[model samples]
Target: MGVLSTFLVSWLGKDAMAGVGLADSFNMVIMAFFAAIDLGTTVVVAFSLGKRDRRRARVATRQSLVIMTLFAVLLATLIHHFGEQIIDFVAGDATTEVKALALTYLELTVLSYPAAAITLIGSGALRGAGNTKIPLLINGSLNILNIIISGILIYGLFSWSGLGWV
Candidate 1:
């Protein structure tokens, strides 16, 4: 929520707070599905690991992979097909640039769903094992990587470097 709020403030500005608020309202609808999958995987993985049942843990991990894959595919399809409409519905009379930027951001964001799912699984497994430091390190490292990548991609900061070939 803090990240979203920061993004809303930074991207949309204060004038569009109402629109951002509405977008967040619609986002909560999708978050319901996300919460279901996330909570289910966390519970199953934690319980299995708590019991020290490696076989059950493995099974739960496999099941979560399958489920998350399906969800990623479904979400990608939905975003690809109806993303513009959804954005429009949520944004109402927002500025065209803001709406377009929001849609593009959403499209780019979905591409990371697989990585997010992997991180979630890893974190869940670590939580089950009662060792959270590793997961925290993993998440922090990924966030740093994301910031670096986003800076390069969005700002063309490394365009001249040409992967050190120049």
Candidate 2:
């Protein structure tokens, strides 16, 4: 979605594109933490299942989900409250316009951190359970939906007004 958003934001202007791109880089850094949690969940769940301990597997999955969700919420709150400062510090000498745009992008995307983190955890658990197909389908559907929604919002369909980026 970030990559597609960068493409959609390009029509807004160079600054908007650069802003989204930079924001995505930072987002990836944050996502890395989620990914680590996801991997740990996968390992624990897989090990439990390997030992034929469904109860342990369930507990591991539940605990990881709770921890990841709480972490994501706290991270999102911090990012939402200090987005401008965070962007400024990360962006260094970038122009004011670019920094502002990046902050806007970061603020909007931060709202999804909880959901995204949960999804990752869910997918990891599913993969651990040897149900890879479901995870693939869920993730694929989300990416397709994201692309469609991004396109419609960035360049409205029919007569609806969009962000005028088109």
Candidate 3:
């Protein structure tokens, strides 16, 4: 996303790139929360698996699911509701169009957090089972999909192509 933003900014203008950067930064902050949750989940799952307690393992999985779901929903809601305000706050003294674009991107991207949470929990569980290959494949696939989606959506290569100045 950063590369795309830089290219767009260079091709179009600072306002466009700055808007993209703001949106990306906002997304990164939200993802950081998920990262912490993921790390905790991984540790807990590993501990349960190490103890050889199937029941506890299952419970750990459920607890992570519940926690991640609530967190993702709350965070998404906050981002969606205050998204414009956040854009404005970050892009102070910037162009109105840039702020608008940044808010739009943020609102649209926040929906992905729930799925991301699920993925993180699932990967954590798999890793706990000592099945590193599956988790690696899943993460790699996700990265590839992310690259394709980002290119298509953010770069306006698909339906959104006409939306940006680029």
Candidate 4:
């Protein structure tokens, strides 16, 4: 999605690419946090399952989900609220267009963090359950959906203007 975002709004010029990259870099921090939670969940659940203690595994999974859910929501809210300031601070030398687009991208993508967290943590649970294929398939499907949506939103269909690439 990061690479595609640059392509999607290429007409906006190098500024769009810089903005997308900046937003993407900031977003990666959120992802890294939840990814750690996901990894920990996988390890804990796998260990509990190894001990043949399904109850412990369930507890571990539920706790991770609850914690990550709240964390995800809080992270999303903070990013959505402070995105412009954050972008400005991070890209101090960037042009106003780049900074503004970075803020826009950050704000728009911030809300999806919760959903992303749920999926990542759920995938971790599945990994513990020894069902890696499900997560692979889920992520693949989501990627396809993202490509299609980005295409439609960037290039437009029918007579629309793709909102002029936002």
Off by over 4 Å in 3: 1-12, 154-166
User: lDDT per residue, candidate 2, 1-166, as tens digits?
Assistant: 6788898888788998989988999999988989888989999999999999999999999999998899999999999898988998899999998888888888888888999999999999999999999989999999998888778867888999765431
Candidate 1 structure quality by residue, lDDT tens digits, 1-166:
4254335345435433444454455555655566566667778878987788878977887888777867876786788788789889878888886676556656656666666666676576666667789988998898787666644553346345322100
Model 3 residue 52 distance off true place after TM-score fit, in angstroms: 0.7
Measured with C-alpha atoms, the lDDT of residue 52 in candidate 3 is 85
What is the TM-score (0 to 1) of candidate 3? 0.83
Model 1: worst 10 consecutive residues (lDDT sum): 157-166
Better of 1 and 4 by TM-score: 4
TM-score of each: 0.74, 0.95, 0.83, 0.93
- List pairs with backbone clashes in candidate 3: 156-161
Colliding pairs, model 4: none
For all candidates in order, the CA lDDT equals 0.64, 0.88, 0.76, 0.84
RMSD for all candidates, in order, please: 5.4, 1.5, 2.8, 1.5
Per-residue CA lDDT of model 4 for 1-166, tens digit only, reads 6777777778778887788888888888778888999999999889989889999989988988888889889988888888888998888799998898888888878878888888898999889978899999998998898898777866788998675453
Which candidate would rank higher by TM-score, 2 or 3? Answer: 2
Q: Which structure is stronger by lDDT: 1 or 4?
A: 4
Q: Give the per-residue lDDT of model 3 (tens digit) for 6-83.
A: 464455677667767778887787777787777777787789889888788888888988889888989899988888
